[model samples]
Each structure stands twice: as structure tokens, then as C-alpha cells.
Target chain A: MNFPTKVYINEVVLRDGLQLEKKLINVEEKEHLFKRLKSAGVQSFEFGSFVHPVRVPQMANSGELYSKIQQAAGDADLIALVPNLKGAERAAQLSVKNINYVFSVSETHNLQNVQKTTLESLEELHEISDLCIENKISLDVSLATSFGCPFEGEIPTDRIVSIVHQVTELNINTLTLADTTGMANPKRVFQLISLVRSEFPKQKLGLHFHNTRDMGLSNILAGMNAGVSHFDTALGGLGGCPFAPGATGNVCTEDVVHMLHSMDIQTNVDLKELLKASHLLEEIVGHQTPSYLLKAGPYDKKYPVPVST
Target chain B: MNFPTKVYINEVVLRDGLQLEKKLINVEEKEHLFKRLKSAGVQSFEFGSFVHPVRVPQMANSGELYSKIQQAAGDADLIALVPNLKGAERAAQLSVKNINYVFSVSETHNLQNVQKTTLESLEELHEISDLCIENKISLDVSLATSFGCPFEGEIPTDRIVSIVHQVTELNINTLTLADTTGMANPKRVFQLISLVRSEFPKQKLGLHFHNTRDMGLSNILAGMNAGVSHFDTALGGLGGCPFAPGATGNVCTEDVVHMLHSMDIQTNVDLKELLKASHLLEEIVGHQTPSYLLKAGPYDKKYPVPVST
Candidate 1:
């Protein structure tokens, strides 16, 4: 029953959340969402990713969106997702304060996502790490498919540990283990996180989970039990992996915040304000997002007593 | 991280799942679903409730449906929910082998649901217990709103503990603590289940949770951690409380089984067969269900890797 009193939430609606979205949101719309989330006490965000425009047209305007919202971030950590050294250079050119260098631990996924092998991606991470150092920008590394690979079933824990070992060697601010295809169960999350925690006790760790299997919240609980506090969540549970089509995206932000707040674990996020942003997200997406809080409201909401016959 | 190696799922879709639906499936259709679930290794079921036919018309054919499917059950526990002594009497006349008597821990909710006080409902449980003994039928008790109430925000732990104390005195086979409004978080679930387990060391206990707040699976996990192995789940996550409209109902049977299986906890239920039944349920209900497995498939399902450019 023991848990951390405070948990940090890294909002990723604008980046990972919108990357697979069909409607390409303009920079102004992305800024509006950013301001709304910032006001709702989201102190960290992944606003957009610096990927090739033609490949991921949805994130093509990362630079424009960053420029428009950078001043309003105000002490908050605004991170951009960078696939490699070129994306890192693009983010640095825009003076982005923080960037998350993500690569898959699964070689097949890595090749499919960025046309690079795991070793090649690690080499690119080195280059991206050096670029961040030169630009005085904070860098975080996310190992996608850390839990399991779609093409290759169960990933060996040693592989993730080795990747973490290599990734932590650089001057990275945080290391995130991403369940890229939502294949992680709670037990696996607990076992992997416990191993990683013991292996790299001093490393600042975060977890990114997808709700495709409806194990998202449970996996997050397991992550918390294993001593990780930071989680990446999307507003209204938007975005799906291009590889895992028809599956859900990240663990939802408002749902996670509501659960944490209910358990007295402070996330410093306002549920009402977050719901407002979630509703706005639904409107922007032109479809309903798979957010439980948006559909059922909060747990404390009381219904009117029915008049007895 | 410790959990039970074996978990028992009590499928309640026939009773709780279809109760809230506008469509009243015929007895034959219900029998088809019942047989399908039975073939999928589901040995326990809450087939239907015995309420005023006009009041809950959805379960009006409980007796006929029970008769149609009872012979095929073949040692499987086919249980019916009874609201009071009259419902118990009706079930006994049908020669029902097992009956579950349910009353809310929250007096206001009890009054609204059954036009009786909590104390009055306990009085009826005594009568139902006597009838069950006379009919040679096993009896179980479910305390609805044991977690939290929609009318009353939080039901005191002492109130629930006292209710459990009074109910366990009868010859009840098992006692279930129900989150009628889906208000139980994992921490609260762990704390309450721990208290109940300590107080009634020999009592066989169960948990009934709703996915309304999306904490159903996590609460079940916490309950398992506290030594309760039996759980009530519905196929396709059907059924909503009449009192709490717009809120989702019981946790999906497939989702819970999927998670438990992923953790290597044996449920003896075939997930693929259960999914086939879930798809049939979707067709029966004439709409898509809120089942994660139906939407996302299982974690081991692999997609064809895109041919790299």
C-alpha cells in the first residue's frame, strides 16, 4: 500500500499524442492546448517531435509550434522528441530547452521507425547527446519497446538493462522505458522496473505506457510500486502507434491524475482544468478520445438521491 | 509485487451485464451465451436477478432462462441474485441451487434501490438464509456500495466492518464487497480488504468492481494482494448501475482474464474462446462493447512489419 506522495506527469499530447492524428493541427491550435495544460499545472511537456515533414506530416510544424509557445512555458520543461542527430540539430536551431531522443530497443522496430539498427541508433544517441551538450540543452532518452516488441515477442530484460546502461552513460537528465505497443503487463513492469532500479539506483527514471490492453493504469501502479514517479500521458488518450494500428495510445493524462489524486498521491494537476483541456482535445480531434474521466467524471462526483416511493 | 498464482472469475454478464440494456434478449439467446461462456471454462455465473418483472424487465425471464440453461451447466455454479425474501422464495420454487442476496452498505442507496433500510435488508437476509437451508441451496451475500456510494460520498469503514460482522454470522458461503459506483481506488481497496481479512480470517471473500472510474483491474489486483481470489466480471464490460447513469459497469471479463493470464495467474478460462463469446455479446447487444480485448486483441498478437523503404 506504500506509494510516493508526489508523482510527476509529463504531458505528451502535442507530440506523441498528435503524431498519428489525421488532422494536422496548426501551430496556433497546439499553442492553445499548451497554454491550457500549462495553466492546469503541467510543468513538463513534449510539445512536438522534429521528424521529416513528409513522413510524419502531423509533427511537421514542431519548430513553429515551439517558437509560438516557448515564452509562455515559464520555467516549465518543454521537450521536443528527436529521432536522431538531424532532428536534434533542428530542435537546437529553434533553441528548444529540452529534447527527448527516442529509439526502439527492438531491432526490427528500430529499423522500421528510423531506418537504423539498435547499434546505429545508439551511435546516433551519442551524436545527439554531444549536440545537446554543445547547445546547453537538457536531453532525456526514451527506449521504446522496452517492455515487448510486436515483431519480436518478449524482450529480454538483459537487453533493456544493457540499453539503459549505455543510455545512462551520457549526461542525460532522465531515462524512460516506453511500452511502445502497450504490451507490458503489471508483473513485467514491476519485474523490469525493480531490476532497473537496483541496477541504476541513482538514475532518474520515468515510464511511458499505452492503454491498448486496458492494463495502462495497473501498469502505472506497478511502475510506482517499483520506485518510478514520472510518467508520460496524453490528453484524452489520443494517438496510436503507426505500427500498432487500431490500438490505443498513451496512458491518459486526466485519468492518471484523477487516480493519483484519489490515492492522495499529489501530481499538482487540477482535474477540473485537465478535464476542460480534455474536452477541448475531443473537439479538436473531431472524435471521442478513450478517456474514462471524460466519460464518467471523477470518482467523488455524487449523484442526486432518488425520491423514494 | 506479490499476487496469487490462481484467480477465480465469476462471470456476471447474463445478470449484471444485460440488466441495463434496453434490449431484452430472449431465453434461448441467453442460453446460447451461457453455453458459450461455459464452454470457455467459466464455471461460475450470476445468470440473472429475481426482481419485480415490471421494475427490472431485463431480468424478468430469469426463471425461464435458468431452466433453459441449467441442465447444460453440469456442476458449474449457476447463481441468481435475489433482492429480498420474495425473490429468494421465487428462486427456490424454480429449484435454483444457489442464490446471492445483495443489499447496499449505504442506507440511502439501499432505500433508493429496494425501498428498504440497510437494517431491514439484513432482516430479509435472515429469512433468505432460512429459505436457502430449507431448499438445500447455497447462499452468498453481496454488500453493495461497500466501497463508496453515489448518494453518500464515502461509506465509513466501521459501517462496512459492522455489516460484514452481522452478515457473516449467517450460513453464507461467501461474502462479496461491491464497488457499486466504482469509487474504490487501489490503496483504499488494499486497506479495506486487509482490515476485512484480518477481522474474518476464515471467511471466504470476493470483490465486485466496476470500471466506471477505470480502477477496476487495479482494485482487483489490490484485492488479490490482500488474499481475496474471487472476482465478479462481465463480458464486454457491460452493465451500468441504474442509480449511476452514464457510468460504465463491471470490469470486462476478457480484460481481467487477459491481465491475470499475462501475469501467469491461472484463471482456467480460454481467452480466445471468451473473446468469441464477447463478439457474440456485442452482436446480441446490437452495439460495440467497452471491451479492451475486443478492440486491441491480446498482447501477443503480432502485426506484419512494414516493408522498409
Candidate 2:
């Protein structure tokens, strides 16, 4: 709990959020969200990813989006999600602050998601790390479906640790244990996080969870106990997986930041500003969101100070 | 994970659903939902709580409902929530299969919720345990707000454990780490359940989480990873705490059972039947529910047999 006191917020509205929307947001809207998120105090952002435009038309102008996001970040770090070394190379070439290398732990998910076995992906991660280093860009590793996989259920924590060990050889400074499919519970979360922290005390650990099954915030709190200070979130509880069955939304940014702030914890974000950013995202998406706190507001008790008649 | 072949399901729709409804649900409608849920293969149930009828008038027929539920549960384990020793004794006299004795872990919550300190409530639990033993009825202990308290932000895990230890003196066979106020995260949940299990391995650990801030199912998954098997859920995601600030519905039974069964993990329950039960409950409540799987049927990849061109 004390460790997560200084949470590093990674805004994923551009990449994870936009990727799920039916209407493709042009480069301008992507730039608008990133700038607004930055002004609202998001420390890091995943601007449009470097995937092929033909494959995902929503990200056709990723290169251009990255350039704009770098400017919008304004000294704050901006990271782009990269599927492979090729994406990493493109991201590294940009002025954007960092690159997050994404891979899946479950081989079934790895093959289906990124079209590579986890082992092959790990090897590629090493190569990607080399490329990021060569280009003088920072890199963080994200293990998708580390908790459970849509195709392969109940992923072993040992399997996740092995991947971490492999990534450690590449000397990546940080790793994220992502509940990519929303299959994590507190028990597995605590065990995995504690295992990772105990094994690699120096490596920074982050959490990426979805509220698909509605355990995103709880999992974050569990990560807090394990001393994790970094997390991934989307505004207005937007974002879901088209491939993963039963997936809902990513843990809402305003919800997580709201819960943390209320606990007297510092997330270095403005609550009202974050809410505004969420509302704007909701407007852009042409949909209402799943954030209850944004609609209801915080619970506060007050009194007309006992009449001293 | 191996031990999770079959998960215990406790249907809280009657008690939790009715407790939160603004309009009064007559006894006949309550019985209808109860019969439908039991018909859907729910092995256990919380028909209604033994709280004062004046406070929760919807629960006035708890005693009458207990007798009716007994006929329905048959071999199924039936239970009820009790706020104090009086409620426990009344539940015991009714000879319901089990009684869940609850007390908040936070002092402020204990007083605000029950007009007594946590210690006083614990003493009442001791008396209830004695009553259960004397009546040859089964009893479970619920440490409310074990994760975090609304009035007191963080209730230390050690304090939660201490309450578990005190309740164990009465030899209560089961303990539910309740996120009464939706303040628990997976990390805290994992650590707490792990501690309780390691301390009292034989004790049946249950988790009762709230989706108030939207992390209920993930918390359950976390709990499962930490060696928990029993859970309390409401049909159609009904129920929220009046005292517990920001508390929402319990983890939806249909959603959790759906995920576990789809993964080939056994819960010995039928998914379609549960959905039907959800529909029945929705009819009685006169509103739609929050359960996604209910609104949209279980995830399926099957497409209609190819038609001749």
C-alpha cells in the first residue's frame, strides 16, 4: 500500500482505447486525447501504436500520431505499444520518450495474438531491447495474459516468472504483469507480484488490468501491497478485446485515480481534470462510459454544525 | 489451481437483492425468485437475513422464508446473514442449515453499522458461536471491511488476521474476507486470504466482494489463486451495502460460474439455467440487471451451419 503511494499512471486511451472503437479516430483526435491526458497529469501515454495501417486502419497514421504525442507529452514520458522489433524500431526513431514491448505468456495466446510462440517472442524481445538500446530509447516489457489466457485457461505463475527471467537477461529496467484478459484474482496477483519482486528486487514492476470481470481496481490494490508503483489505465473505463471472449473495459482511469486519491495516496493527477478528460473521451467515442464515480461524484459527509441553541 | 475443480456457490439474491430494492417485494414474489434460483441448480442460498424487520422490513419473513427455503434446498446448504447475537440466536432457533456471523474489522464501521465497537461485536460473535454449537448448527465468520474501511481508510491486514484468530477461538469453520465497502484490491485480498489459509489451513475461506468500484470478479480470481473455494454471489449482480460507502453489487453468480465452467473448471452448476434464473429475478425486480453475460448470452464461437450458396 505504501509503495503504490506514488503511482505512475500510463494512459492507454490512444492505443488500447482507440483500437476497440468501431469508428477510427483520425490522427487529430488521438493528438487531442494525448494532450488533454498530459495536461490532466498522466505521466506516460500510449499514443497510436506502430501496427500496420492496413491491418488496423485506426492506426494508419501512427508515425504522425507519435510525433504529435511527443510534443503533447511536454517533458512527460510517452510510450508506444510495439508488437515486434520492427514496431520497436519505428517507435525508437521517434522523439517519444519510451517504447513498451508487448508479448503474451500463454503460447496459445501468443500465437493467436501476435502470431508467435512465447519463446520466439522472448527471443524477439531481446532483439527489440537491442534495437531500443541502439536507438537510445527506454523500453519496458508487458506480458499479456500473464494471469490467464482466453484460449489457455489458468496460466501458471511459474511460466510468467520464467519469462521474467528471460527478459531480465536482456536487462530491461521494468516489467508489467498484465491481467490482459481480466483473469486475475488477489491470490494469484499477490503470489505473482510477490514472486517477481522477491526474485528481482531491483526491476520496476507495473500492473495492467482490465475491469472485464470487474477486478481491475482490486488487482491494482493487491499490486500496491507487493510494492508496485506503476499501472496502466484507460479513461472512462473504455477499451476491450475483440479476440478475448467476455472482455469488457479496461480499468477506468478516473475510477483508479479516484480510489487512490481518496485513500490519501498520490497519483500526481488532478481528479476534476481527469473527469473532464474522461468526459471528452466519452464525447469523442459517441458513447457513455462505465465510470460510476464520474456520474455520481465522490461521497462526502457534511452537517450544519450541531445547533448550539 | 488443482484444488479448484469445484467451487462452492452461495446464492444471495433473496437476501441481498431484496435488501437493496427501493420497492417492497411481497413474500410471494420473494418465494418465486427463491424457487427459480433453486430450480436452476444453485446448491446453497441465503434466503433472507435475521436483522430487525423494522430496519429492513423486506426481511420480515426471514423466519417464514427459512422454512420454505429448507424444503427447496433439500441437500443444498442453506444460510443467512446475522448482525448480532440476537439475530444469530433467532437464526439458530429456526434451524437454518448455517449462520454467517458478521462484524466489521473497522471500529468506526462497527459503531456506525451496529452501534458497537468491533470488539463488542466480536464478543457477540463468540456468543453466537456458542449458540450455534449448542444448537448443532454450522456457523461461518465474516470479517467485514477486512480490506479497507470507509471511515478508516486502511484496516491493517494484521488487524484483520487478529479478528480471524479471535473468531477461531470459537472454532468457526469458515471465514469470509468481505470487501464490505469495496475498498479491497486483489493484492490485499491475496495477502489476507493467504495469511488466513496458512494460519488456519482447515478453515473454509470464502470471499464476498463488491463491484462498487468494479473489481469484484478479479478479486474472486485472486482469492482462488490464494486457495479459496467458497464465494457469495447475488443473481443478476443485485445488492449493495447501505452502511458500506460506495459499495455496489456482489460478484454476479452467473458471470463467475460462467467463466469457471467455460474454462472446464467444475462448479457443478448449469450456466443457461443460471441465466434463466437471472431472467426470473429481473422480472421480479422489474428492471434489467448489471450482469453482462445475462444480457448477452455466454461466449460462443459457434456459427450457424453454413447455408448452401
lDDT of 1 at A252: 93
RMSD of each: 1.1, 6.1
Two-chain DockQ for each candidate model: 0.78, 0.16
Q: After superposition, how far is residue A20 of candidate 2 from its true place, in Å?
A: 3.9
Question: Could you give the fnat of all candidates in order?
Answer: 0.81, 0.13
True lDDT of residue B143, candidate 1: 92
Taking all chains together, each candidate's TM-score versus the true structure is 0.99, 0.72
Clashing pairs in 1: none
Q: Evaluated with DockQ, which candidate comes out highest?
A: 1
* True-structure lDDT of candidate 1: 0.90
Q: Tens digits of per-residue lDDT for model 2 on A1-309? A: 233457888888777767778887877877787777888888877776787666667767888887666655677877778888888877766754588888888887776667788989988987888787777888888888888776677677778788888887777756888777677755467668888999988888889988765557767866777788788898888776555555667888988887777656788899888888888888788889888667645433211212224
Pairs clashing within candidate 2: A185-B221, A185-B222, A186-B222, A187-B222, A214-B215, A215-B215, A218-B185, A218-B186, A222-B187
Which predicted model would earn the best TM-score?
A: 1
CA lDDT scores, all candidates in order? 0.90, 0.76
Judging by lDDT against the true structure, name the best candidate. Answer: 1
